[model samples]
Target: MPQHRNISCHLYIGDTKAMEYNVHNVDNRSTAHIVSEEGQTFSFKIEAGTALMSAARLDLELWADGYKLDCFTFTESVYEVDDAQVRDQVTGAIKIVKLRFAKLNTVDQGPSNADDAEAEQLKRLGTLEIKLWRSESNVSQSTTFPYADCPLQTPIHEKKIKGQSVSHVTSLESKGTVAQQSSWGYITTKIDPYDRPWVAFVFKHASKALLQSEGIVPKDEVKEKGAAVASAKGKKAQSSRAKVNDTKNEESKVEDVKFDDDVAAMSQPQLRQEIMRLRKRPGDSLDQSVVKARRTMKCVRTPDADNLLSTAEKGDKRK
Candidate 1:
């Protein structure tokens, strides 16, 4: 009897769910379909391989989701090994492939306006997942690896014991399984929760470098700028309203000061004496009345004006 290995691949962009493919026995050609963000179904074929062959091949053909990855290629040659190499593992290794894609559009997770900076950021975001199992049956399974879990962008920490170097480490186990889901070991810098870090499958490749070159910064800056702009607008509105209120009140206060001839006839000394007398002889002792009388006398014409008026009256009588 011929030994058969079931091949399956699960693809995810960020933490968002994508598609899965399963094929039984690596003997002939198999087909799978993926629906794009644009609601179009595109087909591709997976060519089977034997143990002696260097690598398995994937023939991808797609023109949907505002992306054109017709000739997208991948290889699975690492599984072909001698019996000596297979003994090093219990369940064997899970093959993971990460690729970088640009200028791709997502259905509802991106900005509505295509030209926005946020939209550009979304386009820069890519998908990455692992090919979980190769079994005897066609049963399919899928799982998402967060950006923090990705080897390409995993955060590094230096532990010190009295300022001595201990060891540099990653979250994955020695056999490539995720050791734990701890925040200390991971750094997820993507603004959108659904977006994943850009990581290429080639072990020598680094995706964090691409992130720096692409000018990906923390989204906190965007929020800070927006709040500053709103605060400035509020201050400007308050100033404008104050100016309008001042202008409106100017006309109504034109006759706020009035002069009385009888008040002007009294000298400064006499006026002060009269104010004091009124304070002393008051039936109702509300200090508000005294303050109002003093303010009215201060607004009247001075002693010079009283003398001029008296002279004018005498001249009129003589004529």
Candidate 2:
């Protein structure tokens, strides 16, 4: 029978104490559930300008049987290395780093004793040390931990064999691709002595409104503040609009008086020029003035109906 061991992972940020969690070897069938959980997972928000020196440095360590096995560090100039600039919402700048582990068998030298062989079997898995690096070559970019180039190859038994009674040998390993490994390497962080998977941490900025929207901030406080802001904005907008309307009314009255005086004092050419100038001024109405000016220029006038009737009656009596 194959021997199994429990592995635990711990995370450290800067000089802060390490946060430990158990590591899990997730089955392929349970990957969908893991992905769903990660998708629905929300993070705690840190307010803007909140100085947290620990967030700048990150370290991850893996241990087995209370012995430290692997250590991954990102403590050197973290802010300068990555573009984790959190401007507004907590979801603005998200960094996800996955650490993959591999098993290495102990090579047999000269003559291996029974005790040595047992010890090697117990410590079969090898340690992995990682240092983070940034990639800025592509338009669609991300912070990547390159562990795919070095993979520990191993083989497992395949259940289905083509028309054969015996099981066939097949490989059981990940190539560190999104399709091959959709999770941020699993860890068993439970207290019930069972293996469970846990997703990694996310770092981002959080404002009052953003926190309230994500249910991190109190809803009542956000609502009251939002209402106050809206009320103040509405009053300011109304006052500005009223001032604009009054200015427009006064300007319109002044324009009408000016136009009437210009037509009475100026020649036909000057009146036409004034009309053209008024037409060029946007939002100025000169329909009545233009029509009256055109009629006077043409010397066209309608006689009074009373005078015309009196003249027609006198002509009829004479006839």
Candidate 3:
């Protein structure tokens, strides 16, 4: 949360408030979710200082990454903070959406249509921001949003996003009636100088790894979190290994043995040998049965496979 002038704002994820790191006097960056106007994945709260009027009329503007969202204005004197549902003034649409990380591509592999956008647009790919202006209630009327649809994090060239540290961008959690309803339309306000907001909160969000890489997060905390994650992943990997081992140790059942044309004259021991012979191969008995990505197999040449097959065939033929 960041507070400037007389207003305080916070970005909340789940039931916990985000961790804030101060940048300057009032400007701070926080670790938070793709913020929401709709109260599902995350919620945002605004608290107005008592220094303001009884019913303070202010235009609330939201921006994620670098794109401006549908802005809104409300006349509410805060008792603690304004946590109530904010909706589209005319359409009564609840602008609930999800923020997602934009997929990135290499320099040459970038989107072909990206040229259509101004370089300025791609500049704000990793910031979550809010601006508030002191406004007159009746003077401010509802207006259309800059974008036609729900604003999402636009993927850009990897080289272009170099300094941003952000790996994720705001994306819709769900594409549904909310985007259609708001059109990102906001309440246009009458301000003396629209360029200067009464208060602005800018948050630059990035992955924990990126934050640690930038030294934004303390190394000790990073190690603690990393250890926790590694522990969980280790348990999962161990379970997977156990399953693979079980499959490998499983006995070759009688039904699994191949049908032989040598009639039923072959001894039971010879039949067992046939199953054993079929289990090995030239590549150290390949175990590459699962997905390639999981890759739980070894590749090596084993002479024992040839020896076992030869011995089994000879015994079967002698019978």
Candidate 4:
């Protein structure tokens, strides 16, 4: 029989306490001895049935002074790191180890509601490969990651291996590129050109409507005030033109009639009669008078018969 040496180690349990244990040498095997400060001792033997410890039993307690610790039994197994022959078995063993550590760490600290924390730690440690498999197609994909680079925020960049379609690689790569391009890199604001014009218009209209709704002043009143200003300008222009015409008449030594008020008061029929009389006067060009009269006319309603005759003549000329 080969002699085995006990391996002793100390570990911290929770935040304020520590645990101590000793492994005793046996017949090509080892036994763990755990001692508590309250004069308590527990013993368990590990048999060397296989190269790796398939099953283990442990007695755990706190070693801190003045604190009463609860006793618990934990069953575990050890596995070789590079045992490809029993990869599934090792994977299951590693999962057990992870669960045990999580339970032990949270025993005194209440519930470890940090799902992301454990996942991130596992990712950083980089000891295991997690996979997603499709049952119908019998295809599988696996990803191995480093513990520190695990996604603490959204999963942006992580290595992935796929067992099936080539299209999946292209899709994932394209998605990753788009994600990287759109990531928030010290930029807090973005302006969209398509939305700017409409947004500005909406803001201006909203402000104007709010002012009117609050009884500040109605838009109708502003429009009426603008029309009054335009009317004043038109009256000033007409008066200036009449003064120039009056000066011209005075320089020619002609007795000019006071026709400004008469023209202003004349209705449509009387204006047409005056235009005919002016056209019939001596030295007046009838063609020029007719053009001027046509230019000054308002709302001329031509006979439908005349319109039809004009259209018929135009069609005849075209034919």
How close is every model to the real structure, measured as TM-score?
A: 0.26, 0.20, 0.52, 0.14
Ten-residue stretch with the least lDDT total in model 2: 28-37
Tell me the spans in candidate 2 whose CA falls farther than 4 Å from its real position. 1-219, 266-319
Query: Model 2 over residues 1-319: C-alpha lDDT tens digits?
Result: 0001211222222223222122223331110000101111111111212112323323333332112223333333322111111111232222232322222223433433336543442332222111222212222222342232222232312211112221111112222323333223323222222222122221121233433455543567677999999999999999999999999999988975675565566654454455455444577565654454454433322233234334433554576
Question: Per-residue lDDT for 1-319 in model 1, tens only?
Answer: 1122333233333444334322223223222222223222112222234521422333222222122221222344323210010111334333222233322222433333444543432232232212211222122223432221123332212210123211111111123343443222212222212222111110011133333343432235677899999999999999999989988787545433322454666776666555555555658473654555556655684544444344433544576
**Tens-digit lDDT track of model 3 for 236-305:** 9999999988776663333223232331444445544544444443454323311210111111123243
Q: Looking at model 3, how many pairs of residues clash?
A: 5
Ranking by lDDT: 3, 1, 2, 4
Best by lDDT: 3
Give the C-alpha miss distance for residue 292 in model 1, angstroms: 4.0
TM-score of 4: 0.14
Against the true structure, candidate 4 has what lDDT? Answer: 0.29
List ranges where model 1 is wrong by over 4 Å.
1-88, 92-225, 244-255, 258-288, 302-319
Candidate 4, 89-172: lDDT as tens digits: 222211101100110010223343436544454232211111111112122232441111111122222222111111100000
Ranking by TM-score: 3, 1, 2, 4
Question: Looking at model 3, which ten-residue stretch has the lowest summed lDDT?
Answer: 289-298
Clashes of each: 1, 4, 5, 6
